[model samples]
Target chain A: MHSEKELIDGCAKGDRAAQRAFYERYCGRMMALCNRYAKSTQEAEDILQEGFIKIFGSIASFRKEAKLTTWMTRIMINTALNMQRQKLYLLPMVDVNDANLYEQEEIGLSDFHFTELIRMVQSLPDGCRIIFNLFAIEGYGHKEIADMLNISEGTSKSQYNRAKSLLQAKLKAEQKYENVRGQKL
Target chain B: MKTSEDRNFEEEWKSALDGAEMAPSDHVWNSIDLKISHAEQGEMKKRVLFYQRVAAASILFALCLGAAGWFWNYEDASVKSLASQTVGENQKESASSIAKVPFSNQNSSNSSAVTITESQNANSIKSAVGNYENGVKTRIENGGKNHALASEASNGSDIAAMIAPADKNVLTLGKEAELESRRTSQSNTGFENGSVTELATNGLSMSAIRLTGKPVEQIESARTFKIAKKEQSPTDDQNRNWWASVNGSGGAYNQSSSSNSVATSLFQQSATSTFYAAPNSKEVGVGTSFSYGMSMGKKVANRWVVMGGVNYLNQSIDYQTNIVLQDASQSKAFLADLASLSSNLASTNPYVLRNTNEFISVPLQAGYLLLNRKAGVQLNAGVAADIFYRNTMTDLSGQFGSFSQAAGDNSVYRNLNWTGLLGTELSYKMNRHYQVSLMPGFRYSFNSVLKSSTGSTINPLVWDVGFRLKYVF
Candidate 1:
């Protein structure tokens, strides 16, 4: 297997074998990252392919200052964001005051599987889901998220808070249902 | 700055999603590959078109310059020829006056009878001789005085002396004489020294010949002298200080392919070589070329004209190839990846590559007049630098066949190359100012279009035929 530098050089030259090796090495992680921004598996795959094409085309300009995976992840996220923006632009903006903030629920993290967590995140509205993912999982500041999404910093903060409250309420409801089912059993 | 509750939620989500993985379908890669290929082809086409436009503009500019130069030259030549003709007529009149004095004196002195009939016969003879000499002198003066003096001095020195005014009276003949002379001398003399002074200054022996015969016989002998003088005049070659012309030409060009085995080996070594293999199998069609220019020439010698000017050349070559992909299965696998990713790869056909390369050249050339007459021929040769403007190639291999690529890197090929030119021009003078010409020419390149060590080469040899309209000044 080639090193990151060699892989980049080969990809720049349009070497199919090197491109395949590079794809295989990073596609799993990159796809998982894509899944966070996408609403469905198909959408995630589209973002992944778009990101890879960008990576291959611009490999010649890639500087080694950042990790290759980091660069690829950034590209995937940006591609997904661009697609989301196109779709989301037509939809009406949700006011922060309109969001229903529920009480926080004390549920154990272990109660939810990784797949269940992904589904819960995906279920959020496009605006809130994007904000939550950027802030919570991607560890970006509200300012950066606002810039990336072309929204105000206050909107990013409010949307992130709304996403958290909604998820907490759902987890609390699921735990309560489980308790009732256990009694019936 | 996150609250304790927010921190806890973030940690929970992070741990839950940790090590998560999902594999997209293989079809995604296939779609990406197709997109890249299409982008490349589009870029190539755009570049080729750009170069083509540049070449065309350059040629057009050159043609305009050529035409403007020719027009200016024609107008200048017309003015000059007219001025020279007027001066020639004036000199003829002065020369005839000198020629008439000797003939009239001989006729009058020879007639012995004072009877009106005899005197009238003598006057009639003098008038006939005067008319004959007027015609001869006009032609001789148009031939220039040096030629006339050189050939006719021995036979007509007395007549020459009679016409040459004494140095003191030559310029001071005053308004009356000048006006009278203009009326009397049909061919005027603008000569600085009168014909009499010209003969005396040259130190030629002036002997009067006595005629004892009929006046009609003397006139006949004079006519023979005029014919002999016309034959002795120098060949008519206008030595204009400056001349200009405009010309346009078109021709066919062929570019020789590169022969570097090393680069060919490298191309074959790579499994996914973007460079084409078996370039020779591809057809390189005949190239189209055009050029236009305006030149200014100086008459350096009796039969030599030296000229230099700017010329614009637009040249283009077309190359087409059908390249078979080495591994069909591998491509299928790539497409499968893209399909799995939910992106479709539309094309699976063999790749067809088409490329067009354009160049604009500016040349400075010098021409030598091999023949000069009402109809003339010239030979010209020069060297120029050519600028490679664009190289565009389209690849149509996928099912949709809409993929294109433009090579934007001029350094990949020889952006600048030297050209050697040789040509011959045949011209016909329509009048004093306007001339029409047909030029056949050839151009040879000193460098290949491809950069050194690329294993691919394109060296073009061009032949051209041109029609030119010229105005001489």
Candidate 2:
């Protein structure tokens, strides 16, 4: 396998094999980042393809000051945000009561499949889904999420809380259904 | 902003999706590869177009240079031939007038009327021209019967008195007339002493023949005599002491020093850093220079001439730097906010910048003629005050286009510079009025063209060969 610097140099020089290798190395992880922000698998794939194209085109300008993964992750996040920016402009975010912020509990997610967890996150409202992913999963502060989406900090906080409560209620219902099935069996 | 309860909930979700990976559809990579291929082709096409434009510009400049030289030579030849033809026609008229004098004495005086306009100091010279005219008219009217009567009117001593005046304002015979008079004196019998002897001797002979008791109709056939007067002086030639010229030159220019100023450091900054980094290496190469202008000069002394003119000068320096080329609009950001820039700000491709500086130069020069002849040589020395106009930074590789900045209060270039000049000119006189010269010159700037605030030094030295076409006014 070629080293990261050699692969980057080759891709910058338009080496097709190096470009393919670069894509293959990072596509899976980038696809997962894209999926968290996208509403569907098809939209997630679209974001991943566009993000990789940007990465390749601007590769000559990359100075390698940041870690390769960190730089690529930033590009993926920017691309996903751009794809969802238009919908975010049209859809108004729901403002729940602040009581939802204090009602959080320690929940066990070890039994949930990663795909099922992604589906639960994606199933939230467009504004709530993006805020919850940015705040809970990506560890971005609510103020930073507000600035990125051009929304207020209060709106970001209320939306994340609503999304968390919705996910907890769904997980509890699923656990109850599984227990019922086990009893019947 | 995260509370303890919220932290645990976020931690559980974050760990659950921490290493999530999914396989995208196969078509995504194929589409990206195709788009990148098309982009590479587009870049190649753009580069080809840039080279084509540069080639076309070079060809046009060559054609213009060739056409200017051809036109100058062609014009000189045509004008010289026309001047020779006019001199020949004037001689023929003087000869025909001499042969016709015996038939009409009154008409002879009219034909030979010399309009003498002397300087204010020599106002009495007009009467001298009148006395010479009356002497010839009296001899033609008397129809000379004896050699003594003919000698009295055509006396060589009297003609000498008219020529050697106190103010020297009398008519001076042209070179052609002096040569013709010598031929007549060698062949004829009498009157061989003064400037006008040739025409007087011919007139007397024609008058004596016509008065030989022949009938009117018989003498009419013998009245084929002609007389011509061609009076010219070298001192009175128009624009003999004042001349005007247009000149053009091409040369190589060299910079004797380099600058490590704040401006250069700003431009040499690395692509990713907020603060500009020092250049890894610096190379300053010699570049081409060109100038063209017109000047007016006057002969101040016997062998000295002085001139002053405005010239447009273009000087260039080839600068190769590793600094990533950026848009000029980001200049304000260079000093204001380094953190505002993203990590992807810099490019790895290095480019050459041709620094082209333009100036309007006013030169005052004095020349001493070393060999003043048909082919003359002169030595000249001068100083020029060059007013800065603009400096253009061109990326020769065409990866980025060129930009220009005029000299202003905040500009790096100074508003004015001084240069010392020395040269020798080898010139050839094309005619009485036109001269063509080749001048090879050396020039050196007296001070740096850049402002002291920039902490840059650029003292350029140039060696140029110029072509000058001068016309006496």
Candidate 3:
């Protein structure tokens, strides 16, 4: 496990070994994580490249208390979400009054992986996907989501509910579509 | 701790992402290594060239200065080698002393039994002279047994034959001392080097390199002494050393000149003659020592010689011409007596002595005796040069036949001559090395005129002084 300091100093010196070592160890996990936050495969790959560049460039600031891989994964996620936000697309933010629209249905074991499930959740409209990822998967409360996204607490909770309701209906609708096609029962 | 919840979700997402795989291509690392090597190579080359240049310059400077000083020592070694060669003859004399020993008559007993060691001791001292006298008195009493070694004292006369220009009395004393020292040392425990080993001899023979340094050291020490006394606070030890050096360099300078005449006005019949008598040939071209020097040989050899000096001299040229006076005079000339001619010049101070000075030299030398017969003398030559600074306007005032001071044409006073010298020297070790000798010599400059138009003459000569230091080498 090479540290961020050694990797950074080595990279500045154009050390190929240090660069290759860092890439081989963490690239795979960061790319998958990028896919969840990005709108398309191209967008996800772009985020992975850009985040790694930023990581190497600003590596001097790293205090090294956290694992290097964990630090890298967060950078990748931030890069993808920020790129999507900069596109200025309207987010499907939910109202706090729309809480009843969410359904707490139990999930069944399926051939699809949790990685696939996370990707599906990220495919929601922009605002809903961010709220859904932060509140449900990332476990931030409404107040933290509000502070992080620069929105009101009411708006954050409302957006989180709308995201949950949208994922539930999409899952139900995808199930029905499969049932009608009869490719699987 | 609140971030713990976010971290948990991050971990879950990470686990979900674990199945994905993507690796960086190898090109990035290859690019970095290539860039670094190029930068390092450039820096290393620059550093190496810088160090190489510094090393080369430092080596060159050291070699140049070292070679110049080394050349001076080469000259000294030649003189020493010649002096050492004189010892070979003493060994032959030693053998002859042994041959004279052994005849049976009671009167001849001591002379015939004269051992080599006793003869070596008796060779130079009063005891040796006395013993030889005793042998002769014995031979006269008994007649004929002590005749062999008498021929070898005749050999002392042989060495004396080669030493001309040397004072005979000093030469005799030096020879006797050398023979005595050899005889005494041989009579005592057979000490090394074959000469009577005096304790002082150990300190006397330093080396040539040390002798050459005396001039520079004398200057430095004199300067240091002056500075030591002037300084506000100094150790008593430092002042003591300076005084010791000054005292050790003790010598005196003296000058004398004479002129005789009577029945004079402003001048009379001058004792000094005016005719020029320049040497037809140069004896030797002098060196540019203009400084003192000292040398030291090994303990077995003689040490300590201080010689070499510089002197500055100046003079103006003046002369009379019959052709010029005959051409200018219109009336019948008056007859002049020898005293009147010298005393009342047709013209005096005709040309302004604008400037005149050159080297007037005085050199002091001292040395140690290496062997009783062979001792070294340091020859110090003093430096001098001529300079003419004033002009010839005084001669512009012409002579009054009425013998009155008045102004006239001074343009005839052309070509002022001035002179100077090269203070060069060489050392010699005569048979009796410590016997003091003085062979003062002159170096004359051929330059007769100061400037072509100045009409002044200068006499340039470099003189050397000689002195003896008894070897304690």
Candidate 4:
């Protein structure tokens, strides 16, 4: 039942018991964030492992004015991006025109379970998946996402729109199947 | 510029996934823990190595100091024994010369021999006196007449000729001779056989052996006998006070590990993949340090000395870079021109880069002797102005060869650097003219070796063990 301050102080001094406690307190929430950006569960675990290592290494530099969770979350996002940067160069990201931003459609994600939502997000293309997680879930603007990924702002918006359309189509087909199954039953 | 529908869509997605909790596999924590342990081990090794270098230097200094003390004491004992042996031999020679001199003028031939002996004795004594005054070798001939009979006989065979010139007369009883022995021997005292007699005449003393029945060859050998002469001590001269020393040292040079931004940035961007671990400050290590110099020191006071000299100092460092050849594409900053010239950069080879910095350092130091004796200990503190000469970067693996940059030739290092020095010298006076010393010292640079604009701070510290040989004039 140590306080957050005591836990942070202990972790900064490289106390293993405090680090394990710190991990247990924040890993589950951080794992969900990692899953949103990573394409697979294994990749998400890889990102979480690297992120925690970085957090422990640099915990002494953490400013007390910010929440520990927010600091740890930032490290997780950066770790995920670092892993993605290697692949982005091999599989080049496409640049879209500004007119492609108009093709976005509104969709309801309430009908799906959290696991099903993660699956649909993971099924998107690498560029779309990263851009959508940065824009839609991480609350970053298109311009910020473009700078982070080294792409054009229009490309970030176009990738987000494409992710939304694909999820919309998947949700619509699932709803149609459910209605047909109800009639058959 | 966001629409209300777009805002709602993003908010819904954030709320849905942000609170979603999922546990990672247990192996992830284990991997993180392993990496941290390895990094800690490397840090511990670096700390241990630093202390080990200091300890080694200290042990060598202690051993050298102990040996110098022992040898100095041995030389003192040997000199004392040699002086006693020379005294015993001189006593026997004096007694024999008195017994062999011809004392009788009973025949015309004996009278002529007496005249010849007196003339030769006068010439030998005059020559010996002249040489002694000139601070040169004093060799008395003609059977040790004046010195052996007057000086050795009266002083009980301990004193050689303690002669002081009396006007034109060079042969007389010196201050060391006893009045009673001079008066008794002056009365022409005869031996038990009445063939040997002591005679004093015309400011000359003679012990004549009247071998009237003996062969001429035996008399000739006795007449040619030459006594060993002791020279004046060098300590009596005030001019032989200055000393010169030549010294050599071997040790390690350490840099302050806190600021290594230049090396860090170079290593971090070497590999494109995050799987390979990046090199840290601990990997930048001391390689070798060596210096040799000569200085002239004089005892300014009873226990203090001052010296200044020039030294050629060389320090080296080993940086274990992370730039493997297979990952050379991303690390264009290192050897970029060579990389562009070659098409094949796919080898997964690694090499260590050794950076050597050479300097001409001038040290002005003052020393204080804590124990000033044959075996002595001195504490020295000083400062040096080190001028940069050149730096050579060589691939230790022999693959990349080497390159060098001299001062003001597009070098990143500063031209002038200041260093503080402290040392303790354990010295032994081997003899009147020679001494040997063991000096253990530490040096620390006050400013960075590199330029301020380079954003790299490198203050080097050196621990060395020096051996110095000194000669007193």
lDDT of 3 by residue, B279-361 (tens): 11121111111213232222222333343333332222221211111224431121111122222233221111111122333
Error of 3 at A139 (Å): 3.2
Question: Which ten-residue region of model 2 chain B has the weakest summed lDDT?
Answer: B142-151
Interface Cα RMSD in Å, per prediction? 3.5, 6.4, 24.0, 9.1
lDDT of 2 by residue, B18-56 (tens): 989999987787667656655654564454344334433
lDDT of 1 by residue, B1-473 (tens): 88787888888887778778878787776666556655654564455455444434544544464565556445434323322332233344333322222323343342211101111122222222233211112211121122112111223334233223221111101011000011112123422221211111011111111122222222312211110111211223443557777878876665666554543554455464343433451344456577787777666765566666556666654333333322334232121101112232333333434444556666666776655656666666788777777654434332222222223442455768898987767778887778898777778898876666455566777767777887767
Question: Which fraction of the native contacts appears in each prediction?
Answer: 0.72, 0.89, 0.30, 0.75
By the DockQ metric, which is better: model 2 or model 3? 2
Better of 3 and 4 by TM-score: 4
lDDT of 1 at A67: 82
Cα lDDT tens digits, model 4, B112-137, are 12111212123323322232221222
lDDT of 4 at B139: 25
lDDT of 1 by residue, A1-185 (tens): 68988888888887756777788888888888888888988998888888988898888888889788778878888899998998778873455864448356657769777767787788888888888888988889999988887788888888888888888877878788888999999
**Clashing residue pairs found in predicted model 4:** B101-B208, B101-B209, B102-B209
Index of the highest-TM-score prediction: 1
Scored against the true structure, residue B249 in model 4 reaches a CA lDDT of: 84
